[model samples]
Target: MWISPAFHLKVIRAYDALVTQQPHPGAIDIRDPKQLAIVALQLVEVNRDLQAKVDTMQVAVDAHHRIAKASAGSRCVTDAAKDLQVRPKDLFSWLSANRWIYRRPGGSGWLAYQDRIQAGLLEHKVHTVERPDGTDKVVENLLVTPKGLAKLAVAFRTPNAA
Candidate 1:
């Protein structure tokens, strides 16, 4: 159902040409039945082409949805990086540069930005670690949500994506 911008431009140009009584490449002469039939046939061909493109796009979208659904849980940065086909360090750098994650003021672990967590792109899980003194410390781990993984896949595949 997506109409391309080029198709809209062609329609507008053809309309203007007809209203101005000017001969344009896309303009069809209604006075000639043969020309009108030819234009109708051309339109059928264009419709078929557009439908094919729509079908292809739908398939890609469906595949992405399936992948996102199958994951269905937050994953560590390393696993997400592997799924994205990027180095874990590079992925961490990219996430930091993109403002999706950051290191705490004096902490080594990464933390998700408030906006990213609010947007359901990132999440945090608390882990309890026992120290040598028999004391437990809570550690917060930043993980990427399934939705975030799908978005990252698209962003990584796009040319010139930040």
Candidate 2:
């Protein structure tokens, strides 16, 4: 319940207006109950307005926190597509069309673009697989980071705005 200096100034101005009966600054008469009541009501009105603004700001902060929580970690493209409410194939196609990802020459797996990886929007997770020949093959999987997921969510919601 911290009151700003500006709010304090507003209350002080209201007190001065009621006491001096003028459009300028002055001290209030502590002995007069009627003047005190008018100033009290003005202060209450100002407080109510400030409270409304604070409540609005609080709601925005809460929404931001919820979005941050929902987009907290990187996920595979399939899981990311589920979060975005789009099919995995559609998501992959969109990413490819938008130049966010691509397949290396003669490769099956998708790879993130260098710029996307540098921008902290995408990442790579490498794994080693054993083939029938008993040899380990290194594979890289592309993943969307939390920041990228949030961006994609907004892009998917808007029509032709991404």
Candidate 3:
């Protein structure tokens, strides 16, 4: 719908009266569609530039947070695998080779060193499974941390980029 400049001015005046707004804009009234179109184009360009800046800032913030977390130490493997779109076992295999996770003494499973673990990608969980005879047993599992995720990210992304 085409809004006459007079009507637009009246509406603005009414709004100003209602709000008692201060420091009113000094731009002249837009009487022609061509003028409105030009203003619209300028506004669109300004909005696009603003949005682009916001996107850049957001990316920078995300990188900062990720770096902070990655160096903080501590995260699970399974969740990290999910983030990297790989299997937990496969990730663990890579982690073992990378020395992020180490085997415990006396035939026990691996243990994540407290100092080495980075940002937590997932939490360790205990699951109860029922056997055929109606007996339930508990199983505990751990996942890779942020540092591990960072390692996986670098190792996986670098080769694929080529």
Candidate 4:
């Protein structure tokens, strides 16, 4: 995947921090963008995995909004006990990279949904029918897989579960 130069720099900075944890003593040149990009990408990738977990947990938490409304606070007293109200921007930032994660735009209603689109959750169905405009054409629908679901599940664990 191609990344912008600014983002590349951001990744490198992150990598430098990680590298500092190890023992390496040598004078090195720093004019290679490709080398830097690789290190940066590696750092970004690790954080991305972490972010996925945060995203899935956010999704599950926000999903409770609907249930709260249905229960009408009869089971709980405090507002915090009633709903999981995660902000939409936070959720989107965590999930935008992976296409299968879907949710509504804000922290309001309970119109949220997520599905694994790779190879484990496996929730897709194929259908071939005439186009909506009545044209003689068919469209393919990609479905999510079980592997994707498992990945999401890993993400949904409590925030500090080590």
- Candidate that scores best on lDDT: 1
Report the Cα RMSD per candidate. Answer: 11.9, 11.0, 13.7, 20.2
How would the candidate models be sorted by TM-score, starting from the highest? 1, 2, 3, 4
**Cα-lDDT of candidate 1:** 0.82
Winner on lDDT (3 vs 4): 3
Top TM-score prediction, candidate number: 1
Off by over 4 Å in 2: 1-71, 158-162
> In candidate 4, what are the lDDT values of residues 57-90, reduced to their tens digit?
7655544433434333122112222132434454
The global C-alpha lDDT for each of the candidates, from Candidate 1 onward, is 0.82, 0.81, 0.62, 0.45
Each candidate's clash count: 0, 0, 13, 13
Tell me which of candidates 1 and 2 scores higher on lDDT: 1
Mind giving the per-residue lDDT tens digits that candidate 1 earns over 29-111? 79989998998999999999999999767654753654554466889989888766678998999999999998878988999
Residue 158 lDDT (model 3) = 26
Candidates ranked, most accurate by lDDT first: 1, 2, 3, 4
Better of 1 and 3 by lDDT: 1
Error of model 1, residue 61, in angstroms: 2.6
lDDT of 1 at 64: 69
Candidate 2 structure lDDT: 0.81
Badly placed stretches (over 4 Å) of model 4 are 1-29, 75-162
Better of 2 and 3 by lDDT: 2
Candidate 2: 10-residue stretch with minimal lDDT: 153-162
